[model samples]
Target: MITAADYEQLFAHAPCGYLITDEKWLITAANATFLAWTGYTSDDVVGTFLARMMPMGDRLLHTTRSVPQMQLTGTVSEVSLEIVDASGKPRAALLTATRSVNHDGGVEHRVIIFSAHERRRYELELVSARRRAEESEARSVRAEAGLQHLALHDSLTSLPNRAGLALILERGLTGRAPGASIAVLFVDLDHFKSVNDSLGHNAGDELLTVVAQRLSSTLSSAGTVARLAGDEFVVVEHVGSATDATVLAERLLEMVNRPLEIEGLEVVCSASIGIALADDESSEPEKLLRWADIAMYRAKARGRNTWEVHDPSEVDPAVNRMRLLGELRHGIEGGQLRVHYQPRMTIATSVISGVEALVRWEHPTRGLLQPAEFIDLAEESGLIRELGAWVLDAAVQQGAQWSRLGDGNAPVSIAVNLSARQLADPQLACMVQASLTRYGFDPSLLTLEITETALMENPVMARKVLTTLKALGVGLAIDDFGTGYASLTYLKEFPIDELKIDRSFVSGLGTSDGDCAIVSSCIQLAHAVGIRAVAEGVETDYQRSTLLTMGCDLAQGFHYSRPLAPELLEDWITAQPPSVASGRAAGPGPAHAEPDDDVEMLAAV
Candidate 1:
């Protein structure tokens, strides 16, 4: 076990690659294991420098740094280097070296080499994994930021949306300094539908994007601009007073009015702005937004491209209008709306030919209310269609009653006014036919009166609707004629049975020649088309006489009587002179017609 041959065999066949280097750093000896691992024979590595096995950079480091460190410490453990094999391929290795004094007093290095390929590969994988994790974390942060941006901004314009506007307004109102006033301007583009209809939606979107950019530029650092859905934008800023709001609104209007180039087309647009202000911390966000919305509508009503401030004193009107609208709906459902009939008389005969059915609301507190007080509100609130339907049903029922009670010659036809919304309703013809059928009334006894402006709103659709109504044997009359933009050619196109001249022109009768000419021409035009002409607002006897002389087919106004209840109308008709009831023209009688002064005529039936 202690033989010299055994020791020599152990050194030649060690577990690690064993090598010996002289003081000059040349390999003096290499074990069989080292030669085999490096694909080199012992003879090839015995006289070669150990640095020769490394890459040039590693070779320099081993020569200069490793050698000196090992000399000072007498050892260099686990020095990493690249070794060249017999085939000239570099391989990773960890070398442990020890310096010792040989018999000649020269320093020699004893080295043990280990393959480091797996260790190097593991380190590289760890570095790559760390890089991937960092990239993933960065991507996640960016994605979260992008989602937040999208939630608050309009995708098309990149402007803040309604929610974003609310948040900004909330913060402004909350953090505002004492005595500071914040103004919120609600802006709605005027006639934006025309642009969308004419230029296509893609162009409309482009226009909206450009509008957002322009608004942002114009209000830079002055306020926050937000898009509140479809051609509506809002601006929030601190203002000094109402005058400041007005000035700012004017500036916004000017900015919006500038021509925009979108999709290679020049477009012009305008906006109506409504401004609401908060001077104190007590202001609520919802209430401010609502006030701005109401004011915007007021601006629209005043004609577009204008600004209106919400006045606290005038708030009752909008409130009252809404209250009246609710009451109207209630009245219709509860049968509180009474249909009063005003007799229409033939001008030549002075006899009642038909009656115009007018709806009267006997308010529980304010007494009887006229159509002028509520009809416009009803139309604006989208309640006119329902009101129109109720009126049609009531008029048709009354006409049926008249048919049942009257002789063959008695006037039984009824005229009911239709609002523009009713005229535009696709179900209007069907509703009329259903009412006529339900009441068993002849269609000839029902005349639907539409204003000239209503028909002109959508002429093509109006023509189709009118033609459909005419086919149902129901009469159609143009109410308040000559007050709209209807030309003679346009008039001739409608299948009308009568024209009720607008009271504006009739009020000027016997006073203004221009008014008289308009009235005369309207009557003549009606006659030329074989349709009856009815003169409205005939108050003075002279006006009635003049209309009779001008050959107006029919007339109705206070001259005959104010609108009367059904029972009172029957009594009034019976009390008329036999000659007048017989429809014979009266020849210069009293200078003034008797006014019906009865206020408490009938209770709710």
Candidate 2:
């Protein structure tokens, strides 16, 4: 319905700018709006190149671009642009082009242009908003990633933590191909506590970080290195055979055995490496980890700075331990686990003051199992929590039963061992109290033995637990006192009532001057703090005499009697001369035994 006059009016009065260009894209005609958009007059653009209207950067885009059917279609898609305005400032724009063709004259190409100032402004704002949104989203993602890393990494060494290691272990085990074999190596640094104690925690941290870096750097192709926690690092390798695993493990040992320089101090630490091999069928995180840990302990026992591969066919203590853990859980429900009393005699008075309640697993198929056979397994499997509670309940019940029986004048106290895992349990204090109340035994008659290592693991927590136990009037003794990394500085840190000199030192009292010195110092240390010293494994007269001379308060070993059932101990006590039974029962000659008390005690007991 439009005429030429109407078309002309529409072009002139249109809200958007309009323009016409020839085949060469030269500006042949333009409307007032178009002229105003570029801060140019009709005269200025009449014969000017269309390139002149655009910025130099956009001119190249314009020249090389195809302006298809702008005349035929009479409209073009929107395009963004930046052009110089009246003040020579860059103004944002959106451009659309249409084409017109003249038929009367020789075929001439013509194009129409529309200005989009408001549209370009909106687009620019949107771009800016999008950039900000992207930046914020990126920042949020990074923050979440950092939090996840913190949750699964060690703060000290900046290495994967136990949780992270577990994740990797799970992946390594499950992602293996049908025949793919994985080698898991558990590396433990030797004497790391000595470094922490002597050189300070900062130095220890520095050494661990350096060690972590070394462990990472030393990993061969297709291996992953992670710090499981503390001074322990784990290496997982996709290897072919046992020999390959052995080679990698040896290489790792050599790498970690090197001395490290930390804070201008030379710190030397050896490593114990344990390797467990896994195939698709037998691979699992907990199983592999436990086997590797067992192998690592084996390496440590053989001496550090060495590597040991797990022999699946070999009678691994860890397998037995895992079995024991399973058994312990069932034992509680099935009522197969029982408390066996090992009487602790007074050195000055041979009469029993207490009976250490040792845990015995009466396996239906496997005869009676000693604690040595499963205690370490319990510690490793985190089953110590349940085992410790059982011991507490069983010991308390037996103590109360004995109290009712009343050996003549008074009842004997019952002692039990508490693993480090149990001490870390938040419910330990309440559990102990509940056990005591349930058994109706005076809390004073219950003694708990903890090794030096357990006490030092977490001093604050251990101290809190011990304090609670002491407040309940329960006795606390440091078992195997001189065997572990116990510091004298921490002796008074806990409310300790007794110190049992390790039988190792006691057995060597007469033979080794070093052992004698240890025993002497132990006795002095005990007396200095008003805590009585009980020397275990006093089999020979010489060991007993040395302990007596060094002022040991009590002694227990074969020289007295092996840990016996209550009836056997009663019979033994009844048969002995009243003087020997009530007072000190001396052992035979010092020559009749080797001075190494630990071996003798372990053998006899």
Best by TM-score: 1
Residue pairs clashing, model 1: none
lDDT per residue for candidate 1 within 1-605, as digits (tens), equals 49989977887988778999987779899888888888998788989887778778445655657778886898887667778888888888887788999889988988888777544665687899999999999999999999988999888888889888878888988888899898888999999887887789998888788778777776648589899899989888888888988998998888889997876778899988888898774478777877888899999989999999987556645677778888888988888777887777767657666666688887777888887878778888888888888888887787777678854233466667778888788888899889998989877656778889888878889989999998998778888898777887877899987788999999999889999999999988888887778888899899999998888877888998988888888877778888766542222211122221111111111
Q: What are the C-alpha RMSDs, in order, of all predicted structures?
A: 10.6, 9.6
Tens-digit lDDT string for candidate 2 (373-465):
777666777776777777677667766775787554223466667777877888877888898888787776677788887787788878888
- How high is the CA lDDT of each candidate model? 0.79, 0.72
Each candidate structure's TM-score, on Cα atoms with residue i matched to residue i, is: 0.68, 0.65
Model 1 scores a TM of 0.68
Q: Ten residues in a row with the worst lDDT in model 2?
A: 596-605
Report the Cα lDDT for candidate 2.
Answer: 0.72
